[model samples]
Target: MLKPILIQINPLDNVAIVVNDHGLEKQTVIEEYQLTLVDDVPQGHKVLLKALKKDEAIIRYGEIIGYANADLEAGRWVNESVTRMPEAPELDKLELATRPAQPLESLTGFTFKGYKNKDGSVGTKNILGITTSVNCVEGIVDYVVKIIERELLSKYPNVDGVVGLNHLYGCGVAIDAPAAIVPIRTIHNLALNPNFGGEIMVVSLGCEKMQPERLLNMTAENKRIALADEDIIQLQDERHHGFESMVAHILTVAEQHLEKLNQRQRETVDASHLVVGMQCGGSDAFSGVTSNPAVGFATDLIVRCGGTVMFSEVTEVRDGIHLLTPRAANEDVAKDLIREMQWYDDYLTAGKVDRSANTTPGNKKGGLNNIVEKAMGSIAKSGTSSIVEVLSPGQRPSKKGLIFAATPSSDFICGTQQMASGITVQVFTTGRGTPYGLAAVPVIKMASRNNIANRWYDLIDISAGDIAVGKKTIEDVGWELFEMILRVASGEQQTWSDRWGIHNSLAVFNPAPVT
Candidate 1:
């Protein structure tokens, strides 16, 4: 039986959340109080348990989440309300306490099959990527990929695949502006990504916000590769000829790297070398019950092994950060985490976008009711590890541990930024299921429903639905998943994303201009 608790979030709050629903019937008496059923609150939804005057605060997880726009009463259902008042308390002033660190237990010397680069970074997979500077060159880059698929690659089994990254914004944006900088940095990150075997053939229009010369200059100082005679010759030729000829010549040169890449194999490396990114999309009630928690267990395993795991979708962590704050590495990291929360609050308010509107229409139909409840379940993927770092979108992790990346909750956009930040692989949990994938990294789909997994076995690599049906514990499923990660990293299997040919359909965060 589930126990529900009425959580009084703050002293100023007018309402409390039903945290535990102890399976008690309506009008049941407990702790000197007779509890009545409020509106039928779903797992990730809220119910108002008290009456409040207009402008009274609404609280959850012991923090102010929002305010009431109108008078509210007990037993009322709290849907997505547009009221955005009530800022979070300052982290420095908050009287929160930290938990003592547990004894460190690490996964022993487990290494994925990867390409060891000269710069000391190991790639989980090897790929030949045709990077574009702007949309104007998208056609040329795509054409080059067609040529690779048609003419080359059949002879090179080591080459994972060839991809072209095309974006809508790049030529018309202001140079060095957020819009331009985001894409430029993304491209730079992709080129430097270890998954590429330090081999990239960039295609550009010669004139764009990101110049081919500038892109080349950025990687000139990279220590990953020794200046080989063949690489030098190809670079000189590409610089002399225009874009079209350069694209052709680079395709020929790529064949050479592909031959060498095939001979590489997985070797024993430290588990600490692994960095895993956690994400979920198209969620349903079973998400938290099965796939999410199972992934959370895997996250715990990775962190326990001295590896780093990252969880993004900040908006979805609203109700869940409370459970995570106590694990913060230090006061400064905790403050940054809270500051990011506040920043999202202000950003939503300024744009007049209802924060509760965070849940997509599909999400509600799938059983979620509000952001707070949805957030609670979403954070289940982080496991019980302490958060060592809090990162902005596309920021790389400086330390090895569990991290929370502040990113928009959008699936494609967030997934793209995670890949750009050097995550070699993504563990994407889905109940409703999604087909999105990144250009530079592999995405492994974990399905939470047996029916969905059976129907779409081609798209799903792991079926965690067994958890929902009580056939497996999260720990059992997590070990299975950990083994899968190890195998995928060792190049023993192809991820669903790799098979479907889905790549380069997402980009980094760029704020929309205020009209």
Candidate 2:
């Protein structure tokens, strides 16, 4: 039995969030807040604790999320319609590196079993990745993949699985544009991900703008072999007489990569070898109150253990830009953070839209008032580590720590960028519910409420709902997630997403011109 509870995120906040889905009854006693409700508060929604004039700022997480659209009194429902977005902070005026995080003394001695690559990176899954230069040969790749799974994969017992890096950016677009680097580099990097065990194979459609050689690392021999020509199987090759020929050619090449991956074995590695990407989607008010904060705790634990963690989604963090700058590792990092923020701002402006447009109808119904409120919660997935590094979209990390990889708020696109940056595992927190996953990595889904957990028991991997129900503390759930990452990383456990093979397609962020 659970009672409708009010959650005050910050003492300075003028609003409190409803914790239970059914909401509280009018005049019901809330023992924690020491106040009775004047009206029924819906689950995950906010309740105003004080009167505000039009234009007065609405504070949550101890920062301004928005301004009042009209005068409102205490006990009123402060929904999205009544709050107007405030102007984003000027980039030049943000403070830099004010809250340098102290070294963690609590989490030490943490490690996970992973495969060590020749390039010095570590991988959680030993997989054979098949890369493609265009979408034209997708059906052929899918058909070949099914055959490989049914006929060839059984022989290579050590290889986890095979994934085809199918995406929409290879052809039918302006390939020579300055922004073309975004997709080209993205596909190139996706093949080089640690999980592939350094074996690269490509299937080219013969005449696509993105050639197989272009998607590989260039050698200085005047020849355009990226991964290696011998490893590439072009569909238009003169030797391929028919579709079956192409399929036969692909299977032969795949068997070779599988042999290499099958020989690699998991070994104990320092947590430093682990790079993780964290994101939130289908969010609700309890997302910040429960799952995100608990993820923050787990993030801190990972950082303290000498691991690298990436938190992203530019629009989700733009409203709380001021809070992030001061905690950046240095002035350069703070400025870099501002650059991504400004880029996203201009991007939206170019489209005649703004940050407020990011909040979906599902978001508003789930109790989030606006993007600002969402930002305050979304940024929580980063935990309290100093922003050690900042990266542009499609870039991989040169050093380890807490990195903020700039990416769009779209779940699939962000996950794709995270994979590009070398994250072998992902922890996705959801409130309204989403089945987002990536073929390049194992994603551990954390639900924000018990009701959602109970309803989608098989789909969700872990439940942060206990934090909201007060059955478990944030530390309890955080440690649980941390341990789960190791088990899934070590191949000892499989996430529901992995079991169901529910991977979403790669969505490379193309902010530049498409024509």
Please tell me which predicted candidate would have the highest TM-score against the true structure. Answer: 2
Model 2, 1-515: lDDT tens digits are 57657788789999998886688777777666566677777888888888899999888889888889999877777887788877877888888998878777656677889999988999999988998889998889989888888888889888888988888877888887876777777777788789988888898989988887667753332123345566888898899998889998999899888998999999999887889999999999889988998999999988888889999999999988898999898999999999999988888999999988999988888899788889989988989989989988878887677899999999999999889878999999998888888876999999999888888998899999999878999999999999998899888999998899998988877765766
CA lDDT, every prediction? 0.68, 0.86
lDDT of 2: 0.86
- For candidate 1, write residues 1-515 as lDDT tens digits: 54554434345544444433222345433342244554555443445666767777666544455677888766554555524444333444542327624745766766676778766777887777666666786766677778887888788776777777566655666656543445556566666667877676565555566565554454422223233434422323435566666665667666776777667666667666677789999886567667888898888888878887889897888666666676677777777788777778777888897557777776765545456656766888988777888876666567888888777888888887777666777899887777767766778889876777888888889988776545788899888888898787777888888877776475656653312
Candidate 2 structure, TM-score to reference: 0.96
Error of 2 at 457 (Å): 0.7
Best by lDDT: 2
The count of residue-pair clashes in candidate 1 stands at: 11
